[model samples]
Structure formats: structure tokens, C-alpha cells
Target: MIPVVQHQWKGNLAQAREIQVFLAQKVILKPFKIKPETVLAVDVSYSRFEKCGYGVAGLFKVAFDNRRHKFHIVSEQYYTNSDTVPFPYIPGYLSFREIPILLPILSQISERPDLLLVDGAGIAHPRHLGLAAHLGVIFDLPAIGCAKSRLIGDFLMPGLESGAYEYLRTNGKRIGVVLRTKPACRPLFISPGHRCTITDAWRLIFTFCDQYRLPEPLRRVDLMSKRMRKQIEKK
Candidate 1:
């Protein structure tokens, strides 16, 4: 799918920061009421030696099974793209490096995703524009950020039970939630990227998770991107 909002991806650090600031303003945080029937999750794996990025976009048809009373993936499709990354690795500006490869993979998927799940930060970043938020605004879709680690927030550890979560806040304002999707596992940092409220982000992710810390869509895409990188490394 083509981005509704278009902008150049290559730039210097200063220019990238400026673009993030501009795009961050466009991110809308509100309650997404419609239950997502389809979700597109994306992840990028970088080869340090080759300076290449392998991006994978997984489209999953989701539904809540009445008997199970939980969300499940009904069908899935995977698309991949790889290219030498032009931008160097930077702590806050990951979208600049990853989005170029990811956009192509997104375009390959014919289904329109009801939601976009990203393995990175959202409004939780210092600039309030992380990879998920950037892509969310570009595609004009509801999106959520589910990062494995905290980027810029402090929170008390949530209980060691599934579905337990704590408010992740910065500057006394709630930015996201640190949630434990499984018992005895490290929690994930979840935030609304665009067109969704924090509660919506939390509920969707929690419902989508099945026996894993990462949501099903993200877990599948993460493994796919890693496999793509491994295949290139073997060649």
C-alpha cells in the first residue's frame, strides 16, 4: 500500500529530526473502536557486516473465536524486501533506516490492514515519532508500538501474571503501558502509534498474544525477517 503522506527518507541527522518533528504532529491518538479483522506486522533485521536490512511484513486475518473467546489468526501472508541500508544505526531515528525497505514489502500485500503492529516505539520516543508512529501516519492506519525494551519511560514492574500492566509515563504524562503478556517473562512496552488510544493498544495486543510475550503477528514477522537475514548470510 502506498503511503497517504509522502516524504523523502534519506537525510542527515538534523534533517531526519526535523522530519520526525513534523510527522509527529500528524500522529493522532484516539480510541479505535472497530475490531481489527486484519493486521499487518512488520519487523526489520539488519546485518551488521553487510550493512543490509531485511524487512518482512506479515498480514494476518484475525477473528475472535466464540468458543475460545479469544482472538486467533485465521490466515496469514508474508512479504519480504531487502536492500543495503543507506542510513547508519541511530538510537532514536530508526524509521529512516528501516522504512525504505519496509515500504516495498507493504506494497506487496494486497490486503488492507485494519491495524499495523510494529516492533518499536511510538509516542514513547523522545521525539514522539518512532518507527510505528511514522509508518502509521504515512499509511493513514491505526497502529500500535510493541517494543521489547523501554525507550524513554519509567514504570514500576508489573505483576508476574498474564495481562498485568503498569502505566509507562514520562514528564508525568502517560505515554504507554508496560505489560506482561505471559507469566515469568519480561514485559513489553506498548503504545498507540496512530489513530488509537492507549487502552486500545493494550487491549488489542493482550488479546492477540497467545503463549508468547510478543503478539502473534509481531512474533511471526520477527522470525520471518530473521530468517530472511539468515538466508542472505548463508549465500
Candidate 2:
């Protein structure tokens, strides 16, 4: 597998291979008043011909009412790098290549977020470590990893509610959960990043998930990242 781990943010291929444990490490095992004020989501795009992935990060604040939910993309960052992804596309080290760029963009936000919703895993990893967990560790902020597919663990099955979830554990340790977002829709791979427990992660994700499979803040960000990538490729 490729082992690209960049620390200098120089877009160097060699730097992208320094496999480190994680970039962030704040673990949130308890619950707190999770206000849906601000959230951030990150996604990367690769140039198949150039052998590199460009990262585009989006941070949006939620504007909610009794009738609906909406968001405004207040900040975004796009950067190019030669990060050769290592680790066989595994968990734990996902943030090594992507987060290096993401963290820089996140740090520049004018307002600190109440919560961050990552596009990868949180605790649902082979090492019980995912991108969200890594970011939480580094930032010491409450965060969640919401993935579209399963990375590890086993569960009985989720219900048809918007927030129904089943715990995902490995080696007798609770990692993440298989959660139902919309009734009859595919489940999301959810996990706590740091300073958060399984239950808190579930509550937070369920709240932001709202009526979409992903949180309003992140759902739009995902589309924004794709657009950024397309623009970058066109250049």
C-alpha cells in the first residue's frame, strides 16, 4: 500500500509517506450541550494523471428554524499536494494526508465550530482510530466521523428512524455505530472523534443529520468539494 504522509504541507510525495498515528487526539466520552451552530467537512480530489490529490475543505454554520434547516458556507480552502495515500486505504491514518491540509484550513476559521462532521471514520477503524478521531485528538474539539460505508465491526442492524443506530465494536472496545439517517435509506458509518463517547457521538450525528443522510453543513460541503475539484482539474 502507499504510505504518503505529509507534514510540511509542501505537496511533496516523500512527505506524504510519513505514516504517523494521528494528527488529533481529543477523546470525548461524555455529553454536553451540542448546539448546531457551526460545522466543518473535508474532502480530497486526486489528479489521476498527476498522481496527487487536491484537498478542498468547507466549514459552514447552520441556520435552523422550527420548520427547516439551512447553512451558509462561510469558509473554504483548496490546496494541491503530492500525497501518495498509504495504508491500503485503511482507517486510523486517513487524516495523515488529508488532515494536514484540512487542519490548516480549519484553523483559519473566524469562528470556532461547536462541532465538526468529518467525511471519514471516527472510532470505527482497525486501530479504533479514524479521521474524525484524529482531528478531535489534534484540535481537542468535539467531532464525528460520518462515512457512507462500513470500515469495521459488526452490528445487529439499525431501525427505520432518522437516528436509529447500532454500536460498532472491535476487540471488546466500542468504536463507532451503524446508524440509520433517513427511514429506508442506507445507514451512515458514525463514530466519535475524541473527548466523546459512543452515545454522545450518536446524539450529535443524529442532531445534525436532520432530514438528510448527512448533516446539512456537511452535505452541502461534500458537493462543494466536488465542484472545487472539478475546477482545480480544469485549471
Q: Model 1: per-residue lDDT, tens digit, 1-235?
A: 8889997655889989999999999999988989899999999998967488999989899998767556999999899899999787789998988998888888777677999999999889999998999999999999999999999998999999999999999988999999999998999999999999999998899998889889999999999999888888898
Residue range 1-235, candidate 2, lDDT tens digits: 1112224444443443332333422244576565556665666655555355555555555554445433334454433333544323334456665764565455556665677678888877765557777666666667788888888887768898766788787766677888898887999888887666777777666666666787666676666656765776687
Give Cα distance to truth, residue 218, candidate 2, Å: 1.6
Instruction: Evaluate model 2: give its TM-score.
Output: 0.75
- Model 2, position 91, has a per-residue lDDT of 44
Off by over 4 Å in 1: 48-50
TM-score of every candidate: 0.96, 0.75
As a whole number from 0 to 100, the lDDT of residue 198 in candidate 2 is: 74
Give the Cα error of residue 158 in candidate 1, in Å. Answer: 0.5
Q: What is the C-alpha lDDT of each candidate?
A: 0.91, 0.64
